[model samples]
Target: MLASLLAGLGLGFSLIVAIGAQNLFVLRQGIRREHVLAVVAVCTLSDLALIALGVSGIGLVLHGVPWLAIVVRVAGALFLIGYGLLAARRALRPAGETLAVTGPATDAASSASSGTLTATRRRAVVGTALALTWLNPHVYLDTVFLLGSVASSQGDGRWWFALGAGVASVVWFAALGYGARLLAPVLATPRAWRVLDAVIAVVMVTLGVVLAVGG
Candidate 1:
């Protein structure tokens, strides 16, 4: 049981530690200090649920439906490409205040003062978090199919393995979403933001193209 748990934990980290769209979005939100908690919660919860489904053998069911995979892939590709274009636009034409790194107090005060704006921003952030998590087929492939297959190999220890994987998801997302603020100072400048956005645009578009081509 212990060995299975450890195996699951290790495999979970290995799969999630890659530089992906979901991780990138979480990092950006963390640096911005905008709806970070919500984003982290969404991601963690989504991962846990998917892991559960995978452990219960839903992955096998999904695999049997080839058309479903195709639909998800196409939708994910389109969404990624659209988001990538938006990132490119931001990189090319950044708004001054949007990228400004204000003090904590000022940011809190501003958010507190603008109730409607804050609410709207929160909604947008949550929506994006949901879209990014759910629309990405890689999430299903890695968390569901791969993890599920490995867990099934554990036999009686499969549930323990799933628990470890769930814990790993929580740990990783919490670290990523909260730990990213340490880099806030580095991303203070407009030039830095432009560079970051440019990188994001390239990664997103490339992933989209690869997915579209059935890679």
Candidate 2:
């Protein structure tokens, strides 16, 4: 059981540590002072629900579903391509300096700031999170199928494994959201956004091709 617990922790952490669109959105939102709590809650809740469902025999069912993976892969590919295009668009935009004013600030100081935070748009934050979670078929495979298969292998201890993984989700999302915010000063810069968007584009395209090929 101790070994199983450690295995579960390692698996959970490994899966969650990747820098994907979801993590980027969460990090940007945390820095922007948007609904960080809501974002974290929804992300954690979604993962918990999916992980629990996966552990409860759904994993076996999913494995038996013929061509479902192919369909998901196709859809994921299109989604990633679209997201990559959007990131590329952002990358092509003009760069500028921005202020990291939170809550309220002095007028003189605020005036001295020359740029606007385009990423601070609240709707974009929420929408990006939703897209990263729901549109990415890899998420389903990882949490619902892969994790589920592993947990179910434990027999009665499957529930414990799921619980442990779910707890990890909560901890990870909370930390990623709030923790990234601590670097708001650097992350709020236009150059930083461009770099991030470029990275996102590359990651999305790579994941898309991998999903489409299914290799």
Candidate 3:
């Protein structure tokens, strides 16, 4: 049981620690300090639920449905390409004031001053978080198919393994979402933001193209 748990935890961290669309989005949200908690919660919860499904052998069912994978892949590709274009636009025409880093006090004041706008922004952020998580076929492939297959090999220890994976998801997202603010100072300038967005654009578009091509 202990070995299975450790194996799951290690695998979970290894899978999630990579630089991917979901991680990049979470990092951006963390730096902006925009609905960070909500983003973290959404990611962590989604991961846990997926891991559970994987452990319960749902991956086998999904594997049997080839058309479902194709549909998801196409939809994910389109969404990623669209998002990438938006990021490219931001890189080309950055709104310096909007991207400027602010202290907690200033953010509080601004939120209070523009309550309605803040609420709207919160909803948008949450929606983006959901879209990013759900629209990525890789999430299902890695968490559901791969992890589920491995968990099934654990036999009686599968549940323990799933629990460890769930814990890893919670810890990783919490650390990533909260820790990214430390880089806020470094990205305070518009030039830095432009560079970051350009990188994001390239990565997103490339991934989309690869997915579209059935890679």
lDDT of each: 0.74, 0.66, 0.73
Q: How close is candidate 2 to the true structure, as a TM-score?
A: 0.57
Q: Point out where model 3 deviates above 4 Å.
A: 59-110, 183-215
Ranking by TM-score: 1, 3, 2
- Over 4 Å off, model 2: 59-124, 183-215
Residue 141 of candidate 3: its Cα lDDT? 76
- Work out the TM-score per prediction: 0.63, 0.57, 0.63
Q: Count the backbone clashes (under 3 Å) in each candidate.
A: 0, 0, 0
Over 6-115, each residue of candidate 1 has an lDDT whose tens digit, in order, gives 86786676556544577778877887777889999999999999999987874355367756555556665676577668778878997643333343434777877899
Q: What does candidate 3's lDDT look like per residue over 178-215, in tens digits?
A: 98887545544667767767776776676567657843
Residues 1-215 of candidate 2: C-alpha lDDT, one tens digit per residue: 76456545645665665546677677766765567887887788888888887777654553577455455446646665666676767777834545434542235464446435433544565676777897899898778866675564455566777877777788889987788657656666777767766765675565556546652
